[model samples]
Target: MPALSPTMEEGNIVKWLKKEGDTVNVGDALCEIETDKAVVTMESSDEGILAKILVEEGSKNVRLGSLIGLLVEEGQDWKQVEIPADVGVPSSVASPTPAPTPAAPSVSAPPKLQHQPGKLQVRLSPAARNILETHGLDPSNVTPTGPRGIFTKEDALKLLQEKQKGKPSELKPVVSPAPAAVPSPSQATAVTSYSRPAIPPISTPGQPAAVGTFTEIPASNIRRVIAKRLTESKTTIPHAYAAADCAIDAVLKLRKELAKDDIKVSVNDFIIKATAVTLKQMPDVNVTWDGEACRRLQSIDISIAVATDRGLITPIIKDAAAKGIKEIAASAKALAKKARDGKLLPEEYQGGSFSISNLGMFGISGFTAVINPPQACILAVGRARPELRVVEDEEGNEKLEQHQLMTVTLSSDGRVVDDELASKFLETLKANIENPMRLALN
Candidate 1:
């Protein structure tokens, strides 16, 4: 399992394009790995036959450098090859054993534990243990379906599922007793009622009450990664926010004029370019917080946050400060396309010195975004709306003026970018954006 991204500690095998015994050549896409940001193709580095697939597809959180599969020369009898002990396969899967029979179980009762040698020493995966404990089930009652008689989470879940199907919806404790413990006529006929806990109705105001039960949909790999990163950013980073109202009347005119020249651009493209230029001017605000030192990057790469059906991904535009307006606009379009298609390479979405998250297209007024790690700041862009303001003319007569106003919020890492530095960065950004023509030269 190779680290697909800089922030990735583990990767999920989305799918394997090649199966065991398939021929592989250099540059061949061996599998798709779901990383922290996007699904990337893992290419084979050498020509060989796929000898084995040790980790199954859809297996998640496999550690970096863990053995995922093997490659061998042609006609090498790959079947005879021995798998390493540390290849991550559980011992139970490596060697199968028959499940021990319940010694004192009644004919019609659930499986019961018996005093057997090594029974108390059964090995279980963390997932299996958690599942067993959560469902109030016992590992001894679950049949070992993993290699070397190891109890696996899948085995526990299977038992629980089967029990749910055979028994009541409410799980009951499995008691080891004789089948003849059946109650007599009057005892069996006794009325019993269970008091159910009050359930709060799930509904929206002004809407009709819900009539049907809603099913829980498991989060996708991308959604899970988003949740984890957002949580970590909020919990670990000491974030300082600074907001500024910028007049974008000049930018609006510039965009229209650029369209006439066939250099079509978006507000977000301008924002990204402005951000990169400002980072170059305010180098101190572009540094990252290393545990021991402040690491300032030399390049002015900017991460542009793009929302896709899967999740949010930030594809980097490397050295945006050196690129022209047309170049930046074209690159942003291409990167956003690749991000939505899940084809962004590791280098395209990995490291950057700053980030731009634009929610203007979504009609959001303004919002403070959590900073992406290893980058000191993130610029949140809001919609440029028309607002009325009073202005004094040359004659000193007060007049109501309409201006295109936009609210932008900058979220900075307090460790590296202080309040003053963050405010200065925002000020520079506002100037470049408001001037509009200055961006063309930068």
Candidate 2:
């Protein structure tokens, strides 16, 4: 499977668009691959006949560069093509023995084990199985609490906890129970009351007790990847943050003027333009750390962080320093749409010299964003709230004036961008944003 995203090590085959023995042309979509970031269509780059389908649909975690299928030339028999034994093939297609005749039962079908009446099959989810194995519990004895009488992790955990508390399993005995051991309804209710976990009283006086049950759904691939990357970033990267309160009255004025011409612009678009100019002015801040030395990029490709249903993906606006404010605005809008739709290609989201995350539209005052790997600096944009400032009048008299103040936090990799360099970059960004007209020239 092709690595559709930068951090994608494996991909899940959501569906196959083409079947075996199909005549596939170049640029044809062979399958839909669900990567950590999105579900992307994997198009074929080479034209050939799809000879054999290896990985079946819904197969997950298919390693990158592994053989998933065969594309053979016309007039060539695909069955004659010998696959090397060392090359790992998908489990669905790899077979050592010859094919069985149609009379034989399908070997691919899963074998079902018979159970006693009213007993459930010993099927457990990954989490449930792990919990049971870890706690030395048998799956056959554990009660299935999930939908359709399937065992769930919560059921396994609750059973383990109850056993530790000296409570017997609630499952009915396979054999007939003795009459003396049978508990009455009152006794069973008392036992349940004793086994139930204690709930602390509400801190507020005269408040009703709250009751609830919760289910733990497995995390999506994107969420898991995000967790892993964020954990690594927090632990490995030495981050230093610096904040600046920018006076954006000029930007607001410019935006209003632009709106008069039917050109819509957002605070984030201005921030992106200003950041690009600042990066161009201070190239030292646009650098990444290599093990041996700091690697500085020639072009300023700014990654704009966009949150989608899958996760947060940053699509790059390449050569942002060379693009105008209007162009940046248009590109940013299109990129954000593409990101949400999961239609962005690898080159669009893979690499960048810097990143900008704007929470201003959401009315956030200020917050720091974690620096994406290989991007030395990330600028976090907050809402531009109006603040009263004391100003000098033409007569030299002091007067109060309302100005829109925007807070921006710069998170930089300490190894690549020192405090002094980061401070200079933020200062330049503030100047550019406050002046507003300077961005027009660039």
Candidate 3:
């Protein structure tokens, strides 16, 4: 499978787009693959009738070039070929999975000739070498640290990880010092924080910046995928951004009313409902563009981009416009928990009709987002802040107005959504957020 992002080591098939016995044209979507970075539809490379599906759905940690299934040209014979799991694999491409009952390894015949050996050296796989290269290490430079005279994949990876140590590996221009002149125990008393850094903390109390030496971590599979896709979108697709200020006073009041007694709904939950109602009001905003054709989606499965330890993940609230605030909140919580635990199956993150990304919690004031592929648009919700302006009073007296204003930026693929359509969609969203009661009917 072609990598959607650099950090992807494997992708799990979410759903087979074309069922067995289905004819597939070149470039037809064969299945949906969930990589570390995102869930994407993987297309077939060859035109043929799908002969077999080897990998089961919901399988985890699948690798590239591993047999997903068989695709033979139409009219091929139906019998006698044993499609071994190891077929099409180079001897060098290490198997990601091991058989439960592994056969006895081939016996190495004892050397008839005399042998003289000191250190056992091993060979590292190309994949291992790539990992090393990514860490700015040369294979020839490091001594093999594995057992036997071979450099196994695990050994190479372990060595690389040790070298990285959560920090970007920097090749020393030259060895700074020899292994000498070490300090004594008394001279090496442990000290934690430096005195000067505690003087002024940033306004956000809990958020802390790095002090002293710091490490820049390598992106995980999901993050790498996000980067690549976003880069591709920004470079390949022309994007036009439209934003409108949404008054959240009504929304805040509605959420408080909903939260009375046993019922509880957050501001975010309110936003989710408002967005769904707005999406239904302007159907074009819920559409995905497939280059030549724009597919209008029937359901509003709104995917909320959630933060996780491994990377940013999005979990959908299916038919969100029809769900109550409590249900959405529960779904959001469950999905977030699953995502954080890395227990989300591929299907859990797939099939989002539209997406919403909020930076409100982080106090960000309006930023454009990269559109997820096949998706027509994404809404970037900003934080609410107090704003003041002059207004005509009911008695005709000029008055200074104080209000809660939040900015919502809608980024759409120019190829599908024209400027006028995008504007109207934004207006609808603004109205929904401003008139919170209208969203409650859902």
Candidate 4:
């Protein structure tokens, strides 16, 4: 399989657009491959005939550089294409061997041990082994469900859930005794009033319906990577945070003025521009944490976090400091659309120097975001709301006035950006946001 992204070690074949014996041309989309970050379409780079497909659809964890299919010249006999014996078959497609039947034990023979110390009798898939090891679960406790008495990830997960639910006594529901006779009309009315309808069990497509108190939604490849990376970031990095409330009245007025001319922009667009300008003024905050040293980035590529059905992905706006407000707005809009549609290429979503996460549209007033690693800082933006504050009038009298204010919190890595640097970055950001005209000028 082709490596669709830098961190992609394996991929899932979502579907193959081209089947065997089909004519393939350069730039033709061959299949949709699920990478660690997104579901990306793998396009053909050469003209040929798709002779045979070794990997089937819905196959997951196919290693990089593994032969997935055979291609041949257009004029060649595609039917006679021979499979290479040296090609390693993916585990997903390999046929499982039937487990051997054990011989009957002799009357005098000692009982055979199902499990022995330092060795497990059950076979396990790599994913199943990893899950068991991570949770400190004994392989013997989990029943093998795969062919040839092999344990799978699903088995490991079910065992973990069973363990988490505690013992049988704790799991048993309390049973109420039945009434000796039917209730009267008044009593039945009261019971109906207090009774709640049973909720239907939730289930995902292609998965079995839940038969218990909870439903299990399998984690996608993207979500698994996100979990691993976020966990590492939280454990390994020392994070510091600083927040500032900026008056966005000027920005609102500018947006309205632009709307009249058919030039539309959003609050987030202005935030991106302001952040880029602030980073330009204070370049220290634009650096990333490199092992053995701190590497300052020469360009300001801001990654904007976009939520997708699969997971959250950050698509970068390259050279944001050099782009105008309109340019930034346009880029953000297009990138967000691509992210939601899962059409972003690796370069479009990788290697950003900084990141901005805005939950303002979701009605979040204020929240701190985790820093995207390698990059030193991430700015979390909250929704702008009208607030009453005491202001000095021209005549020097204090009066309460309503102003649009937004809360922005900066999360920085202490290894690269200390508390002092984080505060300065937020201060500069607040200044730029309060006076949005400076952002346009810059």
Candidate 5:
């Protein structure tokens, strides 16, 4: 299997686009692989005839560099291809020492499988083997449905489901006794006042109650990695948080003006532009924590958090300090669409100097976000709400005025960004947001 991402150690085969005996060419998609981040298509790098498949579809956690299939040169007889003894062995496993070699013969014979009497020779996929071994099931009992009588994972799951259905349920229905004579209204009232209500039986402190059945959904490769990384960030990194409320009335006005000119922009687009401008002004906040030292970045690449069906992913806007508001909006829209479609390439989502997670559209007033590792800080934006504030008029008369205010929180790694630095970053961000016309001037 190929490593689809930088941190990907293993991959799951979602499906194979090509089958055995198919003509393979350069740039032909061989299969769709589920990586630690997304589902990506694996393309062929060489021209050959697909001879054999060692690992089948639905196989998970196949290690990198492991043999998944075989390809032979064009014009060669694919049927005559020899299968290696360790076809499915992981690349990390040590190879056994070779025995003493005998003198080569002038002529070589074709390889063949050795079969014994009373033994069933069944071809089982890797996933099917795992299922059978885990349940201690006999392979001979399962009916094969794959090509050449191969027992697939689907067949194994079907057999297990059938066996479960065959077993009788242990819990029997309770038989209720006949109801007593109905009580008068007065008697019912007295009984209600004196008698305690019926309460369901509760399980013990250590054990859970058998309330309802739930389906066991397997975690996808992306979800697993997300869980691991977030856990690590929370446990290993010392995080500090700072928040500020910015008046967004000017930003909203700017959006309206831009819309009149046939240029559509969003509140998030203005925020992104403001963040890039603030990062450029304060380079100390735009840094990452290397193992040995804190490295401040020269360019400001902003990673925008996007929610997908699989999980949360961050697609980056490179050199945001140089891009205008229109360019930033277009880029964010395209990247978000690609992110939701799970079609982001490694470079599109990988590196960034900082991150921004906006829950403004979701109507979240305020929330703290976990800091993505290696990066020093992440900015969390909340929804904009109208608030009445007391302001003094030119004649020294107090009056109430309404303003659109948004709350923003910055999560920082204390080791890289101290309390003062975090406060300064938020202060600058607040200024740029409140006065968004400064973004165009910069």
Candidate 6:
């Protein structure tokens, strides 16, 4: 899978672009991978005669670079390639020779997802929509803060509030109501007036009552797991947050230059890149508290957070610091596509040296994220905004200037990451982002 994302030790096949008997050439898209950050697609880096598939659709996660399937050179008999015993996929999914093959594809496939596109469905309240329209805002750009992606009035109201207060969204709000039971229309049986509680003539008011029936959809295995882990993370992680204002002028300048080709890259991409570099610089931050010992790692594979229909998922952007900007963009795209498709295996979503959650594109300026433990640090990014700064003129007169400012938060495990390490990492990340060319130069 080209180690599409950092946390992706493996990826689950949401769907196979090439089926059994399907011919796959070098650079052909094999499948979309759900990495921690987004759904990115993987290509056949090598020319292959696609001998087998490891896991089928709806399968849990799989390891990256593991034989999710094979890409054999042309004219080679697939059966001749001995399959490893550790390739956990069923033989049927792995070797499809004995299985009935599907019809050959009608056309040659195009390159897989260059970058996974995010779905922005906002169900805004009518009032919120009006405010957004009044501000010449496009709700499409603001992620919905409602159920199943329905933007609510509160979301728009809050967004507007932030804009007016000389602030952007500094806090990534998890506006979850008290865990109410599933919404169900009540089936009621009416009671007669005679059965109602009696009242004096002067006090006479309401009478009858009714009882209703409902069926509830309990929390799924995923939801339950989320509840347990998040709660545990909060309860035990001993998290301490240190936030810093970051200058994104250089990064923004580069992004605008890059977007000219209609090749859109979000600010979060730099956030991802910065987080990866920071992890590399402070390898101690790339560790997990194993309850007994602090386990620091040599390699930094940071998982980027992507929200999915199922819930919050963190797909990895593996070895992010090493990849070029174009490659990072491409990998992020493919990872996102696979994530939404729910094809992620356990490995794709789990294991990370660090986590980066960004709400900057959504106009958020700062926020603290809960600890994603065993990993010592989780970085949160807020939106970029114009800030007034005093600068000296050539005449030595003070002048006010506007700068694009962003806030980056590093939530670290109190047990290991001291304030000095966290602060230095944040500063370096800020410097790198502000001078994004450093990344290119390096």
Specify the highest-lDDT model's number: 4
Per-prediction TM-score to the true structure, in the order listed = 0.75, 0.72, 0.58, 0.79, 0.72, 0.53
- Could you give candidate 4's per-residue lDDT for residues 114-206 as a string of tens digits? 344544456678877776655556656444766446788788667656656574421213356786678898787666444556544334446
Q: How well does model 3 score by local distance difference test?
A: 0.72
**In model 2, what lDDT does residue 313 have?**
88
- Candidate 3's TM-score reads 0.58
Give the Å shift of residue 267 in candidate 4. Answer: 0.9
Arranged by TM-score with the best first, the candidates are 4, 1, 5, 2, 3, 6
Estimate, for each residue in 256-349, the C-alpha lDDT of model 3 and write its tens digit: 7766766777778888888888888888778887778889999998988888766677888999999987888899889888877666666677
Better model by lDDT: candidate 4 vs candidate 6: 4
Against the true structure, candidate 2 reaches a TM-score of 0.72
Q: Is candidate 4 or candidate 6 better by TM-score?
A: 4
> Model 4, stretches more than 4 Å misplaced?
95-151, 155-213
Candidate 6 residue lDDT tens string, 1-442 = 4566544354445567888667887789778665543455677767768787666765544544455776677788876766776755442344432322333343653332011134233445676666665554444445554433455666666666566565544333234558744544452234223554532221111533333423334443345556777999999988888998988888888899988977677777777877777677767778888999988887678788777776777778787878777777887778777777766655676687888888777777788998877888898888888999999999999999899898888899989898888888888888888888877764
Tens-place lDDT digits, model 5, residues 1-442: 8889999988888899999999999999999888998888899999999998777888887888788888999999998887677555543232543332332333642222112245445567887776655554555544466544567877766665555456323211234669877999878866653555533332223456556523346788999999998999999889899999999999999899989999998999999999999999999999998878999989899999999998999999999999999999999999999999888888988989999999989999999999888899999999999999999999999999999999999999999899998998899999999998899887
After the best TM-score superposition of candidate 6, give how far the Cα of residue 169 lies from its true spot, in angstroms: 59
Off by over 4 Å in 5: 86-214
Q: Give the Cα error of residue 387 in candidate 2, in Å.
A: 1.8
Superposed model 2: Cα runs more than 4 Å off: 5-7, 19-21, 51-56, 65-67, 70-87, 92-134, 138-214
Write out the backbone clash pairs for model 3.
Answer: 36-222, 37-222, 121-149, 122-149, 122-150, 122-151, 123-151
Top candidate, metric TM-score: 4
Q: What is the C-alpha lDDT of each candidate?
A: 0.80, 0.79, 0.72, 0.84, 0.83, 0.69
* Candidate 4 TM-score over all chains jointly: 0.79
Give lDDT tens digits, candidate 1, residues 11-122: 7888999999899999999999987778899999999899988878888766677788889988798777778776565322345545565344345532322233544444
